[model samples]
Target: MEKQPSSRLGPLEKLRSFKMEKQKSFRLPGSTSFKEKKYKESPGKRGDMMLHLAARAGNLPHVQMLLAEAGEEGAKDLVSKQNLDGETALYIAAEKGHVEVVREILMVSDLQSASTKANSTFDAFHIAAKQGHLNVLKELLNLFPALAITTNSVNATALDTAATQGHVDIVNLLLETDASLARIARNNGKTTLHSAARMGHVEVVKALLNKDPSIGLRTDKKGQTALHMAVKGQNTGMVLELLRPDVSVINIGDNKGNRPLHVATRKANINMVRTLLSVEGIEVNAVNKAGETALAISEKSGSEEISAVLRVAGAVIEQQQPSPHPPNPAKHLKQTVSDIKHDVQSQLKHTRQTEMRVQKIKKRLEKLHIGGLNNAINSNTVVAVLIATVAFAAIFTVPGQFVEQPTPGYTLGQAFVAQNAAFIVFLLFDSLALFISLAVVVVQTSLIVVEQRAKKRMVFVMNKMMWLACLFISVSFISLTYVVVGKDDWWLAWCTMAIGAVIMLTTLGSMCYCIIMHRIEEKSLRNVRRSSTSQSRSTMSISMPSDSELLNSEYKKIYAL
Candidate 1:
């Protein structure tokens, strides 16, 4: 009763065969595996220990087996083994969020001695918190709640690490168990609020401050507070949040004798300056250690926008006095003349650039305007031809048919005089609409083909004529409807006329709305330009695209708490 041979091998057998096979018996010696070969290059040790690799790979069963094979003392030693980086099984498990493995390691390792283990240089709680693993952090804290107060080698507590990485939940958990951990400083004397703001995490910054507002006042090694870091990070949201609790930090100086305003101006951060100016107690005119104010630095940096903002906030620029020890009169006069010539040349060059930019813009607009005009003229020609055909056909086919001329003098439909008046009105309006629309088509075509010199002026004149023709066409359409149904039912005639009026209004309203939005965009662009230096238009920004672009970007410039 022997079994038959299988056609395919199982995975375990395949893997075992792969491990047993050699490259080629004649080529070199028996080849080492890539893992063994790579480890041979390092000589003394493999990269990660088997225990650490099993823990990192989430192999809870293998980890338990390894510990079970080893007796109590041997399993304790295995749990305490470390990799080259000094990270133990618990540390790697905690970092990668392997909860059961971490629990096993914690259960085996001596708790009191393991918290300060020589093999693992870093705190396991800090690693879990920094990596945003709430479950592993909870397990670690449960095993040794005292690890919450322990700082890593870098002197950063779990709370500070969590806040820096934007782990809001982890920070909250650590803070709940040990409320005093919020005030503990990292290596540089900076609190969690400083790290949160520096990392551009507004929610984390607010959360850190909610537990302890005084954390915002603690300065870093650079002698700057959370507001300073927020401004430096160019995070408008974080800056506003930090300043909301304490506006006094707005004027506080750093070790380099730079206030937040000075640093912002040096970096040419226009939004940062705007936020600082928004506060009521901000001293805009206060000078730095160099005896220069934010306005002075902004002026020197050629930031016209920031300078204008500072001036609007009542920042008075100090006037420079002439040197008392003046040079020789003739030498000074010669230097003044040279300076004047240079200024004039710079002004002329800037003016030429401005005119060229304007010409480029006009050319682009002309192309778009001409394209729209051609489309309109083409569509209007089709409509005009249709209207002309209908009008000519109506002249012959009157609403009420003739009755053999009615004895050679009486007009047809004489019994219905009001209906005859309606017919006459329709005929006159229809004729006028046809003629005007036809004329508009001819004029617009001629302007597009031959009239190139006064094209703008001609287009303007043609636009007005096109509107006039549209007005006549609308009136004629309503009159024709009235004539068709005047005697049969006057109510239907009035209803159609009202509907036609509504259609006309809707068409005109769309064009009006576009014009209004464009004007708003123009007004904002003009405001931006107004802050630029009068002596140099080169500093002015390009015109904004549309109202919506301005609205969306408006938040990037300012965010009030």
Candidate 2:
């Protein structure tokens, strides 16, 4: 009887029951609705958040599970989703050295996109490099070899980051992957060597140099090389390492023209100064942009020991004159010549009565003049030979090397850079230097002029040729720099040219000034001599007593006595 029935409810009864159920599910005026609550607790969003957490915890299993649950499209979204710190699951895993987790996430996600997307500052490869996660780096590089060159937010590549952090193995690996990374600089223009040397990473510096020694020659925005950076630290070993490969960098100047020795002196590092000075070819007296030498800087810093070291190493403080104007060598030379002329004229006028004295004076002047000409000839001969030798060597060892095998556009034994404009200019200038120097050598050796005037004329000709040869050698060196430094560093070559131009132009200007001034003085002296002779002739009777007349008057007085 009780079961008869659970009979179906009528339409009004069903409506009443549905209304009761809806009210029970409904929210108050300020309460959250069912749809809003369901959205707030979405599984996919929670799973993504967990994925980041699990990856950071290095839980490879949990990461895989979360990624699988998100499926293909959803897994990509989850893997790329960044937290408040802009860190993705892959970035965190890589940073934490979770190699398996990195590998797992990379397997499912697009590596190019994931690696390219930086988290806050650095991406996975850079972070792993900075963290010294060698295995993680290997995983990233193995999957995407291009990641080795990918730059972080700071415009630093993985190699730069690793070298800065002193990760030797990581640095070596990255270099092996792409040796050009050693040349890649940061936003600050600091290469991997600069960073390693600055950070006092001796081993890392060694590794970098082993890959490419020329990288040691690279300068930063401040015109500082690896040696310049090395001297700033307390590690003398680092300095030695840099010097071992290229001792030429020992004298390389920074923007302020401060070499390593100068910098060490400024820092009051006596040991460093001693070590640098002990190096062969160290320019102890090298002046800086401010005209301060290492000794000068040490004196200014009040470091007695460093100053003593510098002085002992032949470092002399350049004596700067108090004069506000630059020195004029031409004016000095003219004054010297005029004084010599006046002295000689006065001596001759006073000694004219003594024929033997006049002969002696003439012989003395001739001897001195001949000696000067001999010295000039000797110096010119040495310089000419040196220039000729250097030019000969340069022609044989052409920049960019000669072609070993004949190519479609090349012939055997031809220069690889024969067609390059820079190489051609180098060859032309080098040949000119060689031939000009040879000519000078021939003139000095084959010709022998016994007369003083003839010898002076020959010396002058040789001197001019030597100057021209010197200029050609400088131009040749500058032009060859363009071929050596490559196109990317054309500015470096230009800088070398600018510096060489300044020096050469200054020297040539001074030489030209002296020559012009000497000519003008000689012309004026000749005119003065002509005018004096004319006046003596025109006023011979009205003028004061001549030397003969004075001597005769003295003889008459003596006879009266």
| Per-residue C-alpha lDDT of model 2 across residues 183-252, encoded as one tens digit per residue | 9888888888998898999999999889898988899899999898888888988889999888999989
All candidates' lDDT scores?
0.73, 0.81
Total clashing pairs for each candidate: 0, 0
lDDT of 1 by residue, 235-293 (tens): 88788788777778788898877888888888899988898888788877777667778
* Each prediction's TM-score versus the true structure: 0.49, 0.51
Clashing pairs in 1: none
- TM-score, prediction 2: 0.51
Model 2 residue 475 CA deviation (Å) reads: 99
lDDT of 1 at 352: 73
| Native-to-model Cα distance after best TM-score fit, residue 370 in candidate 2, in Å | 93
Query: After superposition, which runs of candidate 1 have C-alpha atoms over 4 Å from their true positions?
Result: 1-47, 112-121, 319-561
| Leading candidate by TM-score | 2
Clashing pairs in 2: none
Residues forming the 10-long window of minimal summed lDDT in candidate 2: 552-561
Please give the lDDT score at residue 196 for candidate 1: 85
